[model samples]
Target chain A: MKDWKGKNLIFIGGGIAMPPIRCAIWYALENRADYGNITIVYGARTVGDLVFVDELDQWAQKERTSVIQCVDPGGETPEWKHEIGLIPHVIERSNIPAENSVALVVGPPIMIRFTLPVLDKMGMAKKDIYTSLENRMKCGIGKCGRCNCGPVYVCKEGPIFSFEQLSQLPSDY
Target chain B: MSDVIAKDDLLRLVDQWLAEGKRVLGPVKAGDGVILYAPLAASSQLVLEGFVHAANSIKEAVFPRSETIYTYKFNGHEIELSDVDPDSTQCIVIGARPCDAASLPVLDHLFNWDYKDKFYNARRAATTVVTVACSEYDDNCFCTSVGLGPAAEQGSDAMLLKAPDGWYEVRAVTDKGTALFNGKTTPAPEIKVPISDGPAKKFDTVDIETFLKNNYESDAWRDITMRCLGCGACAYNCPTCHCFDIVDEGDAAGGRRVKNWDSCQFGQFTVHASGHNPRAVQAQRQRQRIQHKFRIYPEKFGAILCTGCGTCTRNCPVSLGVLNTLEAIAAVARGSIEVK
Candidate 1:
């Protein structure tokens, strides 16, 4: 209830779901004084799939925030010196403190499925974790019935849902 | 006071509408035991007979299958964009079934929710829907199960009930309906229409809605959707299934943006750009279809997204009906099985 000023911001983004998180990253940097310690753990199938490289570098260079990048095994290049594995494995190994942290993750479905459990083990409650669903939506409004999860239209009700909220919906998507 | 118009007088109304150069769409005989809404030029063409409702609902009267929301033109170097205005032309829609008529208000809640869809709103404003009460029943019709009736005039401007002796009782329900009278009526008090006998309620929706939420992770989804072809014939023909995709057609310089009907039944509906599909299989898609109508839409809109029109089952190749799906959920609600 103390607002986001003191909350540690963790954004786990990779692949195509990176843009929205990158937008959030820029917002956090612009209003950096409004937030606390920021950590971004991002990964991909390969270094080539990594998005927002410039921004990632900028975050890594920031004095307060930490940016950890990773690539799947055998996907590392000669220039790559970071961790080699899935993002959750990297974060678990990096040992970032989970106290007072609210993490927003956006990535492939498999990545989300694996990453959330890792965050849970780090002491993050289901309510503290958030992800958006782009569930095959149409009519961005609720009129179109395509992107629904257990009576919730992902387009109108969410492009965003917390882990606790996701648990309440049907597991169709 | 309400009055009755002769069945012949109704035809004269259609003729007058056609003479006025206004868009008149009504049910016409499509084939044996089938009727579809189409442009009407003659009163003789209206087929307010047989079937629970027309093969298609009155949805397209407001939200079309595809329409240009914005038009963009590129001339050599410069590009100009124009906004498509809501249709202002007078349009009269006659012979919509009670369930189909009820769909307009159901759709109103959604089109107006989150953001107002002006394209749909415009057509809704321009069109006056007149519905016929049902006197027949089909195996697929189930409006009663979802809180609507065979003769419920929830969205109609005019109510046309077929009575004995070839007489049609026309009750003007709204200002638009009243305006159709133009201050003329031959009050025929003897006109009486026996209430329409609607199809039996297949399953209770309240029980189904509750049971569906708790069984999201259940395996019953796979068994129910195993034979699904994902043809999307249901979504397309449904009066309340209003999913649409916005696409930019043409070239990079300038292209017109169009909204086309999209379906949850397709695999591409939830595929990410990284080639990952969350609802990767038919069971998931089928789960999405059921939960949307029974559970999700109700939570947000306070109404079921289905009219129980059964157009989907009627058109589906596999004969996979929504009634069967609802019954399956009802079975779960009765505690016979957990749907797991």
Candidate 2:
């Protein structure tokens, strides 16, 4: 993220996967001058399931930042003004710019699976899209030998990887 | 000229080390016609010959099967953690096979790779390995396959080869070995101990590695490893299988965090809390073991994770050790066998 100065940072997260995305947003916002426009597209199954409600409102009002919050089709309430759809579908409807933009995505496996092709179709290069992986890690180092996708240990080499890097690994995880 | 020590003298040296309060481990004839590396109480308990390889590797000297890393105690509002001192008693491993000795250096890379394991490092530093070169081998022995042989010395502080007339030709490899045998050996320029040309190369490691890299999704894994019972006997007996698990054992009051030897062959090894298992089947687990040893470890650490000791094959319940598996893989690679 530090390497991509003056580039737009798009964060897409789904239910319970907001922590890492939140962290990256904090980093980008703290160093506001270092990055270009920041966009956050976060969603949950229902309005009650959504996290950081106050923070989302606070971020939306910040200069050069936009927050798009949503819920599943039946999950919206009467007072809800945000979008209504699955996270991937919501991201598709958002019409996010892919040029000179990096996407950081975090979500459940199904959400990630559906969201990846959406970003790809939006003209985002595989290298510009990143995600975190989790495996049954024991040692948290490479020695325990359980957490690996081919030669790469998710604990050691990465819990974070670019889509391009993930493509090179076997789908063991 | 080669330094020689009589068999009697070597046993006497073992006694001397034991008397000096050093932990001495060597091969002994355990009951039921089994040979294992165990702590020697006296020199007479040491079994110098009559086995190709011990049932277990000498790895327990440094990495025990289970060890307490730290103990935690809980108070009303605070917790107290106590660190266990890694045993640093001066230790000697006598009569270890060359394959067993070689695993030490291979393991050294892992214990110190990124986060230096203080427990492993401390014990490793205090231990000295004395290897006995192979004079005989059985069908299961394949040290030659992986670029190691009968007398190949990689991690031995000193190596002892069987010489004629009840004497051992001692080759001091490190300063510790030299110091141990200082003024104890008699120079014998006339005698030479003959070493065996280890097991024939079963399969090329490069070919195995290439096949592993290219054929991740092949049906050959399921076909070749169908009979593997997932017993993990192979991993337990392997000289270089270093996978382990860390667990906190106790109630709410708190207990000790322990590291225990783990195997990739186990079904629960890679199961996530969410009930998803990546390597879900026995074939996938078998493939993981081979890939880790042949391709992954070598690529990451620049050293293969196998010593080709054949201990896994020798100890496997079914006949499917690494050698058999690799042979099948070689057959697959050559198109001699087809997986439908």
Candidate 3:
């Protein structure tokens, strides 16, 4: 509800999280003028596994949203021109500046680990990259110790966190 | 005068509370030596001398294991959202163990810290916690080591202590508890013997952090967690272990996103939709479970998220108690390589 007005947002990673991320993105893109340009670079193992494919295409048609789907090599796909390489390579080839743009990373843990270094390579400091973790959470509130990744419950302190915050915690996270 | 209540008088007070329409729930003897918390309709329902902690914590009465948070409907292309308000009944939880009551305050910090979680805070605000001190101890019990006493003021608004000759010491520590005896009250009964407070139980958790940090790739994890079935019983039964999953269930016309308790021990917890799981192996999941409680929780919240309540130990299908895990790590820290 706050003025996300004038912030360029990008979501990297694809999964069950994609729908929720898209839900939030749609909310932002609805207020596009309020929220600056929105772009989503979604990565998955294959094109068959991409979530919200049609929805992403429709949003990109309006130019209010742009989506790049990354698939593994030799993965099944119908020819639609988008970023075709792995996530890190796509980021390297694409000229998306990391200085001011907010990037949301949501994917498997290995993807999370691999992407952080790319952000580091691009000189993207921790704060600019936001990621959401899906730890086994029961109580969205912190009372249940189930979602604990140390001091923060992934449910309460965040399903959303910065790379800087994640870096400080123990590696088990 | 305000501290002591005879056994009959104590029962009458509970009856009076229930008579005044307050919901009273206490520990009940469930099947197979399991103690569960349920509504106590009569004085005889109270278990004044139970040993182990309840099968589940009193948190369920407040923060249920599963509850709907919100509902969303897709109408054509637009979406409509609705809020889920928690139940607004005043409930009293009696016969809560010391560890169970103590664990609530630790949970309060994250619930009310940044964003105001109305669901948790609402139930917490409405409910009065009555903690019963432990008369017996187990080797797995470590409440004393973690800044808690057998009879401690961790989270109880009012604490009930059983004294000799069928007398109970009723001490009011919070305003709501004090208000229970505001008007013209009957005189408190005298006790025959002073309450017994036991010595602190000691365990060497002294380098738990260092051990975990240094032994990231140790084979000990695999050996210890080999018997884990990943059933999540340990998480489900714990008093302080609160993790959850939010899922949207329903048709396009209307549906609800309900949150249910989740466990890190399960492979599905961190599995992406692409069918790739981060913690596919149980060792990684087991490591996560331990570090999250000991190292990570303290790192973020300045308090270890465990009360050493031994619920996990008592209920584990494989007998891989978290206490033994900590002890193993501490033993390794002390340079003992003998595998248990």
Runs with alpha carbons beyond 4 Å of true place in candidate 3: A1-173, B71-80, B181-200, B204-206, B213-217, B338-340
Worst 10 contiguous positions by lDDT, candidate 3 chain B:
B184-193
Better of 2 and 3 by TM-score: 2
Which has the better DockQ: candidate 1, or candidate 3?
1
Please report how far candidate 2 places residue B248 from its true position, in Å.
1.9
Q: What is the interface RMSD of candidate 2, in Å?
A: 1.3
DockQ of each two-chain model: 0.60, 0.66, 0.28
Per-model tally of clashing residue pairs: 4, 0, 19
Residue-wise C-alpha lDDT for candidate 3, range B47-150, written one tens digit per residue = 76756677677878677888888989998999999998877678888888878887788777657666767788888888888877777777777776566767
Residue by residue across B153-208, what tens digits does model 2's lDDT show?
Answer: 99999999998889999999999999999999999999888877878888899999
> Which CAPRI tier for candidate 2?
medium
Each candidate structure's TM-score, on Cα atoms with residue i matched to residue i, is 0.90, 0.92, 0.74
Candidate 2 whole-model C-alpha lDDT, 0 to 1: 0.91
Write the residue-wise lDDT of candidate 2 on A1-173 in tens digits: 78878999999999887876898899999999999899999999999999988999999998899999999999999999999999999989897888999999887766776888899999999999998776889889677888898888899889888889988988776
- lDDT per residue for candidate 1 within B1-340, as digits (tens), equals 4477777877887899899988898988866857888888788988877656677777888888888888888987888998988776788998988788788888888889778888888888889988888877778888888888778888889888887777777888899988986554567877667785577878877778766767776788887778899988888888888778788887866777888888878888877566767788988888877887787777777878888878878888898868777776677667675644
Estimate how well candidate 3 is docked, as a DockQ score: 0.28
Q: List the residue pairs that clash in candidate 1.
A: A136-B269, A151-B295, A151-B296, A152-B296
TM-score of chain A of 1: 0.93
